[model samples]
Target: MSKVSAFLRKKPLIASLMILLLVLTAGCSGSNNASQNTGKNQVVKGGTFVYGRPAPVTSFDEYSEITSNNAFAIDKVFEPLVAFNKDGKIGNWLAKSHSISKDGLTYTFVLRDGLKFSNGTDVTAKDAAFSIQQHLIDKGPLAISAQVASIKAKDNKTLVITLKEPYTPFLSELANFSNGILPNNFGGVSEKQFFKKPIGTGPFVVQKWDPAGDLTFVKNKYYWQKGKPYIDKLVYKLIEDDSQAINQLKAGEVNAIESLPLENANELKQNAGTGVLTSGSWSIEQLFFNTLDKHFSDVHVRRALALAIDRPALTKALTFGYAEPANSLLPPAILYNTNKTIKALNFDTNAAKKELAKSAYPHGFSTNLLIASGNSTTAHLAQILQQAGKTIGININIESIELASFRDRFFAYNFSTMINGGQADYPDADSILAFQTDPKGFSKSYWTHYTNNNVTKLLYEGQKTPDGPARAKIYANLQQILADEVPYIPLYYPDVLIGVRSSVKGLVVLPNGSVRFDSVQITK
Candidate 1:
């Protein structure tokens, strides 16, 4: 078989069936507005910009949210104090301007005049402070809350945030989903009831939501940005299948679709009335090992696994020329990612076998890889690992778990091994380094129960130092250490490809997997 064909090929029968289904029902189930799309340059107001989002939303509580996709939906209804622009630089969003104290421990923000929530009540420093406090109470993104000492609403427009120490990522962390401003105390409703119908100072208001169906949002007339959100309504229609979503894009049933399958990206980019927004996203598709397990406890075994797969070849075969193999824990797009600077553990079958012989499980050991089902790319990865594991005398069992349960198990650190991926919340190296490398991080340092004094020290060193050559040196050393230890194997860095209609304008597909929708307008 040819190289590309071999890697892309899977269970032929199932793959054939899925392809058949895509062909048979491509545009048949599109929304009522399904029709031929025609491109135009003029911006038209009062039109609905329907977005095709995969999977129904199960949660909208930003304070305790787990995944970026969940945050994507909630973000539409809640604007941040500040947000990263296309360049990953922090820019003022809700806060008109801000300044930091000389010691860098305190920050003062002045709210934009006439700011109001979806309910028309004015947005004040109190609301922002209350939102930050709520995030801390809910234990959202520990790195963020752990640094914040206190938040004070000095006046309706001025807010002061004091940190226990000078945390460099504090501003970027505030712009993340976990710190989005909401109504003070959830608008006087129970926590459960409030998130059920959340209100925020965002571009759109939640009109209705169905966990198993579509989520509709109407233009928030009270939205801080004047004459903005030109679309009369924004709808996140649940279309789980990539082919079907692409079909809807062509048929003009959906203005945009998230997570466009890489296989079809080139085709969609070439197709008329359709354009694909793709970038070298700041993320990685990788395997997380549970070092507590006897089989994985040995560094030799972990390194063996890393050397077995040809990351470059796999990425090339899978991404359709859209991305490069991840040479470091951070993707190449991230600043100071160390992709080219530090060489990765390249494919070495003989070296892998030698490393396995050094481990106690030289005769081989069996382990189960728990992965969430429904993702074809992940399933394919499991198969490749299963095959590679055999060469090293390891017996691999692939466990396909449902998405929701998989998350529950992962966060609890209840697994032998798992395949997972995510984009950094912010653009900086510290954004991911703090959470994925710090021992007390969100993922418990890549969910392996892995810990290292050197990594821990470098993580904090990188966080405390401001971004520059000095800070970059700290992260480079950190990456080198993690690479040698092989706590989590660096894998492919796939580009985030979003399917957009030709007429869709002002939509920003951020490399961090969150799109900016406030300025998104459908030009008809």
Candidate 2:
């Protein structure tokens, strides 16, 4: 057995700590009554909410596609076993109650009585088991089926899942949108047919869909949550242009839009008729170095590049003081943060030059910096890096490509350096750490091709250790090592800027960029 497994076996207190961490990270539930009024505002429902999305949704099937745009639309139709409430607590949705075994390897879930899908079919434990099996067969980008050793449906209402090993973040992972349950016997449905018409047990049902246009939804009359989903109709209008969306919001063509540019959001905030919401986002804009590239193979070269750019200035210029400079992959507010201050790589041209001299290329070299076109913020960030590189005697050529092409090339490891955004599927630190650092994980090629046996061991140990001072110490050491290794340069954690019409009430934007419309009401 590994040292972590041995430690877990010896320490009885670790199990309690694990439960507490799960609760802290998963978020708490609200009232059982979904339609309970806030008491602060009289919810005047029965209105059509025109929501503007920045991009067209690629697929309605969460199991097949992973995109924020798709999630915004799917959240209305599909209900996960557990969901994060507005307060960011894990709450029972499809499952009425759940329990974890003392050994941390078994999970039992009881389905809510009278649960039914949009088509009036019962949502049983067998359906949940089918969903897990489908995830395993499909092997989607966010699939977690490998974690399960076996899943058994005890009855129509009971499900028991046995894990291959102890996974601290299992509950939180189940709360992800990708794990949303599908109906039983859905294996025969083709991917194309499922994307065209997907069924779920959520508050709304798909009414109509127009490709590259607006997708409309109507309240599910038979929705399990009684008197909820106050809005009569919800429409997601695809507007690819940011400026055009802002103009629509100003002109009262749209009720709400998320992820607005910082500058535009600031301007909307100044308008009396506009309501702007800004909160620390789970997303981070970062620069990932291709460690396999000869130019960045040397640790000194990567360190020099990390030290050359100014993160604070970039945050201010790009997010207009709405974001905080990132010191580690896990945000300080997250439950896993150690609070130990690690020395950050500050911008210093002289220091960067000195570090570069230690590399094979004493006189620095040239490389291309890849970025997605049509993103003004990333474009400006690339320009700043270009200027910083000149000061350190390195020539950086900025290359902007279509978003689709950029994603393809990035995952294929075709770039020397790439500026992009990444977020954990769940609130746990293991989500990000495992994806970015686990050498045997699914995202190994997509991330910086960094391989360190010691770091890998530390990461695995951190996952097994319960949330406490010991776990904190493990993560602290990991962060310090990553900071020195410089596989990725942490930039800033951007704020989720959202603009809403002043009359739209009870709309809450979560830190993870999910907009809650359960209690939303429109007042003309």
Candidate 3:
């Protein structure tokens, strides 16, 4: 079956019809509109929006954030030059207007007048230029920065950037959390000092932050957007348990639950008025391997694990029929992503055993699966993998570590196997696809150290190639190459779920699973 046909088969009859209707009227948000109160008087703002956070957030260094929890929290206190709206359209945030040269080599942006950081510091073009340059300096972590040749502040109000080549994803790259603009030269302070208590041209200012507990944010009086961030304060309380999160949502304790699992969607929707909001995203939950590890060094072992996973069954177990099994590294929703039936090494325990038998460890070996602590979803994923590995005589040990240590270990390439998931910084495929497959890509910057020459060439080709069928063909080829190589086992591309109180209005969750709070209002 094709991607769409398979997707419909996985969902309920009602949901399948809804999906067909969605395809007919494509741009409609697949959210609970009646509960969100779209037509309600959203202008009545002034309540504190207490959002429940599912994991620990220790860092505020926007450009170096390791976890989505940290990124989502800090996003309120930092502003990006440009961002993708819910509709996948790029919109100006800090820039009033922008223009690209005819050759597409040079780009100029005019800063919005009267822009100021949370601390009331003037947000100048120099600050914007410095921020972009700083991100570029951290070259390995930022794939998009490689496209830039030079960044200069033409004037206090004008910022110009010269690109090494004509790249399509530059604007979307700016939307990445790690690319948020920082104060000029770290506000005349050391990088550590500035990040300790960061200030930016966002709608909120960090008031108090407890990495293991909760975070409080006050409305930014100096925010460039006038009379915005409807809520006066935002308290992000850390809740690790899924049950507790749902209880809190229903008890009227918190207005939002970040990263709510789909299994609890119905309970929340039935009990709490309009408690769930879901958006299609490019996010993929996958299991990665350290290619150099003793057990995974052999290609046969890696490919064995890929075929061992029952993706259809795993998707149902993980999302409770809320998500479709991911057919490729990129979700079918993304541009240039193909839904054609692939010759994937799908679930076949017998084939998996045969491949494992060919490896150096013919009898299977023991390895630890690293996941962030307090994430029930990943914990469950670990359990499922543990059982599945057992079927093939592999002993899977799960190690749940805190966010801080997880980051350290991940970047250090210390683990044998790990459960990881993420979407592109923006909607474009290269924002993540190349970052994970190409040698100059994922292995260089991310956890997966897998490399292929063909993947790298295709990635570079896809970047310079303009938006058309030609680019799509290049990306499609790249996907096939990665699938065959098995750098990672793509589990499923999940829908971004948020359990929200019906009273919360004007909240915007982007397709990449990030939320915008500038317009969020809490109603009683």
TM per candidate comes to 0.88, 0.89, 0.87
Which stretches of candidate 3 lie above 4 Å from their native place?
Answer: 1-42, 401-404, 440-445
TM-score of 1: 0.88
Please state the error at residue 401 of candidate 1 in Å. Answer: 3.7
> Whose TM-score is higher: candidate 2's or candidate 3's?
2
lDDT tens digits by residue: candidate 1, 1-524? 00001110000000001010010001112223222234664444666778897666667887666565466777788877888765566778899999999889999999999999888898999999998888777885433633788899999999999989887777877776667898888889988898999988888888888978898889899988887776677888988666788888898888888777778887877787788776556667777788888888899999998988888877877777877788787777677778888866789999999888898877888999988775566777888888888888888999997666776787688888888774576545666666666677555765687899988998888778876789889988989988888888877877767788877767776656667777665554
Worst ten in a row by lDDT for model 1: 7-16
Q: What's the lDDT of the predicted structure labeled candidate 1?
A: 0.73
lDDT of each: 0.73, 0.71, 0.71
Mind sharing the TM-score for model 2? 0.89
Clashing pairs in 1: none
All candidates: CA RMSD (Å)? 7.6, 7.3, 6.7
For model 2, which pairs clash? 26-90, 27-88, 27-89, 27-90, 28-89, 28-90
Clashes of each: 0, 6, 0
Best by lDDT: 1
lDDT of 2 by residue, 236-269 (tens): 8987677888888887888888668776767887
Off by over 4 Å in 2: 1-41, 338-340
